[model samples]
Target: MLARVAAAARVRPPERTGALLSATLVLSVGKGAFLATVMVYLLQIVGLTPLLATAGLTLWGAASAAVAVPTGLLVDRGRGRAVGSVAAVCAALLVPLSARVHTPWALLLVLCVAGGFDSAGNVVRRAMLAGAGGDSVKALAWARTVTNIGFALGALCSVRLLASRSPSAYETAYLLIGGGYLVMAACFATTSLGAGRRGSPSVRAPGVVGARSLRTGGALAAATGILTVHTTLLSTVLPLWVTRHASVPVSVLGWLVMLNSLIAVGGQLAVSRRAATREGALRCFRNSAVWTAGCCLLLGLVRFAPTGWQVVLLVAATIALTGGELLEAAGEWGLSAVLAAADEHGFYQSACVLGETTQGAAGPLLVAGLVTAAPVAGWIVLVAVLGAGRYIAGFTTPPPHKAIAIDS
Candidate 1:
């Protein structure tokens, strides 16, 4: 009976892939709902002071970053599905608890725990995407496209909550977000694409094995970390730049953000196709550097432009930035998958996640400080930094013989 049950749990690759994407969609929507209304809910409904709220969020980021590598190490021990499902379930319970908490300490505790679970789930999911058969980059691209769509739909649904501005409305949104995480947990529980032990262990010591894996994958992780500054630039810096420096009305920021979403949703798959090979991935990185640098330059010049050209340049800059975003995502997915050892997906993925999470934790302060201190010079420095990072990333590419054979 146990053997039969185990066999039954082994889903086909196509079915597992579908489940993974469905899970991605669900998770994205939940995050979207939470992100769209979280600040207002915390400040107005819960009546927390801005400093407390910011501190709680900072703790959340810190917790997530702290747990990423450890969670990845656990996943490497043949527990990917179990670990991911458990993390999702924990998040499902913690999110609504967060909504109900009135005390500042409670809010901080709930967010810190939830953030750790969320980061663990993300690392396992990325590892699963790499292990999913046939064109990992393509699968990741589709998942990203679905994510954008889910976020858009979730945000649109939250409009009523934002409009009502009532405690009940915000609580209801949290309940729905929790429900989405429950569904995501179910998806992880049912899928087996990236689960289970690969084979017998190496004779080497565990510490040596882990250190070797990290050493092998460290360069790609650094490159990914450096590139993540673009996320900070787009989401935080650009909005502040437009509001403070450019003459455009604050209302224009919404359209610019929407344009970025539209471009990512439409172009990600096409861009990902170009990253199917090592050479192609490198090309994508180079292209991303060019597009991103151009975007910074254009946005920096917006203050000097006539009012008419300010909007025009803003739109153009957004388009360029979105293009860079698409290429960077595809290249990262390709390189991470190709460079990873067959049995060490979790280790390599966790390293990458550690890099990304560290950047996410520090990026806001770093980018905001630079941009606010010197708007024009900050943008110039960013352009140079991005260029330098891309150049360094090119040199980090392992020889073709070391590359994993990911099917196109």
Candidate 2:
């Protein structure tokens, strides 16, 4: 019986790809712990005032934003593995060093460095998967599952540690996360996924992506940026819209978030199965846009519905949003892998990250300016824009056959 169960689990991605996914899981676990404990550590252990801590966080964000594109460029130069390893090592070191640092300046400096490494590390992982041939969407779907589980586990573990309410326990948690990073670094160092020599030739000297290809990539990036509004809708827009406008109880928001997370953790694999090929991926992308627009429409409908019906509409909207989120994620992974130039996954993914960055910077303002002020009009405009994306997505062509092969 045990052997049968083990065999059942063996029907998974190739062994070489496990390194990246495992690393992501371990790193995500550490990040989960860090998220729960960092503020307390900064205030209680590092002796930084709340304002200084906020400033340190702000500096870290700035540093991450500044380095996002450059790091992608670095990965495109065939240094994905090296860069990921360095970032992992730095992340591992940052935790222990953070416990030692007390001054705001020192904390800011440490956070800034960590932030850059963090962004670079994400780029490396995504680029590696984009170049890793053979069912990139499915691999990413598995990755998302592992990441969610790891984060949930880490958060639960952190809760136990924090229950002690002792400074030493916090230190121990940081050290534990450092150990996870060490494991992640080792995975990158030993794995063959995009770990070419440190001094390979430039991937972008010339003729890497033609004008047409670059333009297509750019448009995809813009669409991705627009899709980031889904995140904003979940994190910012929904909370405000529901509480202030939707006439629903505040607790429903928490339940909705839980539901979304659950769906992401459980449903991604099933959704990714249909996205194995480029045509299927494009189909999913178009459908995701339709679902996203439907979510917006549902949210808009909440205001017009009766009191009891409002809850139903709101729930429906959440479901639609989650579906769109999962479908979009799978489709994007497939698109990134399918549309990239040969050996240029890093550059292509980096270009896509530009959209994420744009969303991060602009989404909040747009939500405040549009959704908050005129919910119906705002949603209609979003629907129109995303509807247009459905048409644009149909134009994406798959890369050549050889380009889809796994990186050696």
Candidate 3:
């Protein structure tokens, strides 16, 4: 089965590839702009209290999570391109409205609906890539790299807006972001990528097959979810830990994040290539566990280090964490591709997204709370959990030859 799929896989034509990647870049730029400015806009311009802002964002996340599977189901039924384009357009229309919202209820409603559409757009994009049939992991890696570049550019643009401290500046940023989404919609609408297995006999009665695929994909997701904790640690816990405990200057945090992004942009493609096969993906997963564990240990010791060494250790730890991040991403993509039934890419992809969404939603508070309370012990607990997850992944992932047989 693996060989057969490989044989069937063909490189996308240059025009299609260009269109898809261009859309990804545009979407990511909008995402980056939104992330860089949304909180400040909500708090300063919109006059929401911190607690209300948090609650509204939480509701947005919930809406995204709630709609993921249903959007995926729609994609599986041959509507991926249509759904993606429409979702993008809807999000484009709704996001600018956020600039007009002053009340909590109005803000919450806008965010929730926009979040659902954004999440649906992402699900369709991933499903399209998965079903695209040729070196999909590498294709995704390129997309990731482009996304990072777009984000960096967008964030740079936001620095000017942030410095201006003008409400008009923020509103202008939102308008540009909405325009970006409109461009993304046009790209999706014009792309020629086929809807995989749509209307095929194999998918007609997807009930039993989808259930089985979901169970398998869900287990894969659960096993890998521990690795995703690193994301929260990178974005939220690390800066806080440094500020509160380590002697390292708070100013250094920005550089550390930049280093991670640089590494991801430079090395993600090479790492992804290594994980294009099942066995290679397993190895990547194992290596990621080791690197992440080392990172956790090094970070746990930061407070105890000499001031000069604190910076060194932090840099080293960031490098290690980035290594883990790169490998984990490649491994997950490879595993999902090999494990999913060819006709059920949307179902399996949805299961994977569900895991990521759940983790993203809950991880920050839990990780930040524990790490702040018991720094060393918290890191140790994380290492243990990650180790256990690695072991579970090894047990659950079918051997490559066996997976092929099952598919056959």
Query: Which parts of model 2 are misplaced by more than 4 Å?
Result: 1-11, 36-62, 95-109, 158-171, 195-210, 304-307, 388-408
Residue 57, candidate 2: alpha-carbon lDDT? 61
Residue pairs clashing in model 1 are none
Once all C-alphas are superposed, what RMSD does model 3 give against the true structure? Answer: 5.1
For candidate 2, the per-residue lDDT at 338 reads: 71
Give the residue spans of candidate 1 off by over 4 A. Answer: 1-15, 200-212, 399-408
Give the least accurate 10-residue stretch of model 2, judged by summed lDDT. 399-408
As for candidate 2, its clashing pairs are none
Task: For model 3, state the Cα shift of residue 236 in Å.
Answer: 0.3
Q: Can you write out model 3's per-residue Cα lDDT over 184-225, one digit (the tens) per residue? A: 888778777754446645744642344446556767667666
lDDT of 1 by residue, 244-343 (tens): 8888899999999899999898788878889998778877866787888888899889989988899999999999999888988888877767765555
TM-score of the candidate numbered 3?
0.91
lDDT, model 1, position 315: 95
Q: What tens digits encode model 2's per-residue C-alpha lDDT throughout 109-174?
A: 988787777767777777777666666667767877888788777777788766676777777778
Identify the superior model by TM-score, candidate 1 or candidate 3. Answer: 3
lDDT of every model, 2 decimals: 0.79, 0.74, 0.78
Consecutive 10-residue window with the lowest summed lDDT within model 3: 7-16
Task: Name the candidate, 2 or 3, with the larger lDDT value.
Answer: 3
